[model samples]
Target chain A: MIDEIVAAPGAGRALLDDYLARYAPGARARGMVLEQVLVAPPVWLDDQSNTLTIRWSLANAGAWWGMRAVSGADSAVAAWWAEVDARAISRRRSFATAPEAIVRLCDV
Target chain B: MFRLTQLVTLADRAARDDLAAALRAVGRRARSLLVEPTLEGSFNGGDLLVHASFNAAGDRAAFELEAQALLGRPATASIDSVSYSSEADGREPGLRDGIYRVLLLSIEPGTDRDTVARFEAELLAMPRHIAAIRNWRLSRVEQAAGARAWTHVWEQEFADAGGLLDAYMLHPYHWAHIDRWFDPECPERIVDARLCHSFCRVDRSAISSGG
Candidate 1:
């Protein structure tokens, strides 16, 4: 679940929120801040290849600090970058998948 | 997340008896007691008459008797109020919808017989209750409709936890229940089993009953 969640766009918000909720004092000391939440539609680059993308941003130093405090600096940096890419990819995929999911939901 | 209720199947008499017993045992030892009745009404999908409660030591004695009678478990029991709740009641009832059966308990860590037993029991009972309600026959279609009306009620009293405040403002009962079952920290647990199998079997039921 954590893996998939991190792979999700706007996952940074969730992760940041969780960190603050569980470790607000540590978050404050680190300058963790959540700048925004972005949910993108599923994208389908091609019917054959089938790719996805998502996009999001953050404004607070705490966002990075929060990640470092919770996951450690090295892993935190990796997680932050992962969130950035995942958000963009998820958005692209959502645009591609939304119609299908909605159709499936309705048809089923 | 997909509603877990979709996987439920009705429990037989023997099963219900066993579940009742288990519920009764736990109810007997709770610290506080609260009963949320599942009124037979129509709203969300239709109402599923559920008598959920929280009971601490004061009400534990009676709760234990009832829950044990409902589920058949005999382990050391302790609990708080039963947060009795039902689907919303406003719309008409129908035969196409499913009902809900919920079981929430917080046993002391390391004290429970099998951590997942009670959780599974409650999860399994939902279908049984739905099946029982569906089996009842009413002579007149309208009369039967009316009879089914209160069986499942739908209400939107539950708040949506989206933004930060939304998460913070969640009712303590809801959070407590979630924490007990879903929280990563606590080994203690609460189980809520819902079944929408009926809805899929038939067409869309009235949404007035709480879904």
Candidate 2:
């Protein structure tokens, strides 16, 4: 899962921390291990949103689906996002797989 | 030439293969027949599709009568059938040995004509972004007589199964743009959820060879 966050000038760091602190535990419990967290520009003052690209990984498609079912059933996972939605201007989450696994994962 | 296509929902899922075989036998009486069970990625699409073409226009009625009679043997739940000539035939020479996909959908009743036109234009524009759609046709259903009042019959022939399941379905234009009309969550959605999204493996061109 990747999150594109559009926020006020310097609030991205706090928002990122808030997400990591609040959502990370639930995410890990649901079978996702935070592989990496990187904020573009590290520090930007001009006119640009500091996009947070957080990535996670699982065992395989089976584990990913298992995580989805578990996460879906767990209300805290969605509740956390609902609580945090007000802080960001716009937030979007996307699920993707590595290009090498596309043929096998997407069943193309 | 007349092409008669029916998206059928069987009362019993176990009898699908047998019913498909029986339908294939009935379809053979026509010039060409493609009776095959649809693979996954189907929303409200039926169990299988009965796609048959006739050389003479009058043969359509006779074939339909026979096929309709056979429907009672297995106790079909419902069927959405369309008989139409290729209204917008784009039989480009890209892929002959490919799969044929057909989508039957009804525009939400009472949608403004301009919005519906835009929806169709956006739908037709899909091939521009996704080149895998080898042969395509977007036709207004001449006669939509079935469980639902279908308005449009959009079909595409891809170079291969991947060209459909992957390239066509996953393309950004399909989900990001064209999908809004089909997605119930989107406010721009105009299509009803009961859509017949069915496809079959066809080594030959189902649209071009219908005549």
Q: Per-prediction TM-score, please?
A: 0.23, 0.63
Least well predicted 10-residue stretch by lDDT in candidate 1 chain B = B136-145
True contacts kept of each: 0.00, 0.03
lDDT of each residue in B142-166, candidate 2, tens digit only: 7897767888889888878888877
Residue-wise lDDT of candidate 1 within B99-154, one digit each (tens)? Answer: 33222223334545565565434333322322222221101011102111212221
Q: Which DockQ value does candidate 2 get?
A: 0.07
Q: How much is the lDDT of residue A77 in candidate 2?
A: 60
lDDT of 1 at B123: 33
Q: Give stretches of model 2 more than 4 Å off.
A: A1-108, B13-18, B91-96
lDDT of 2 at B19: 78
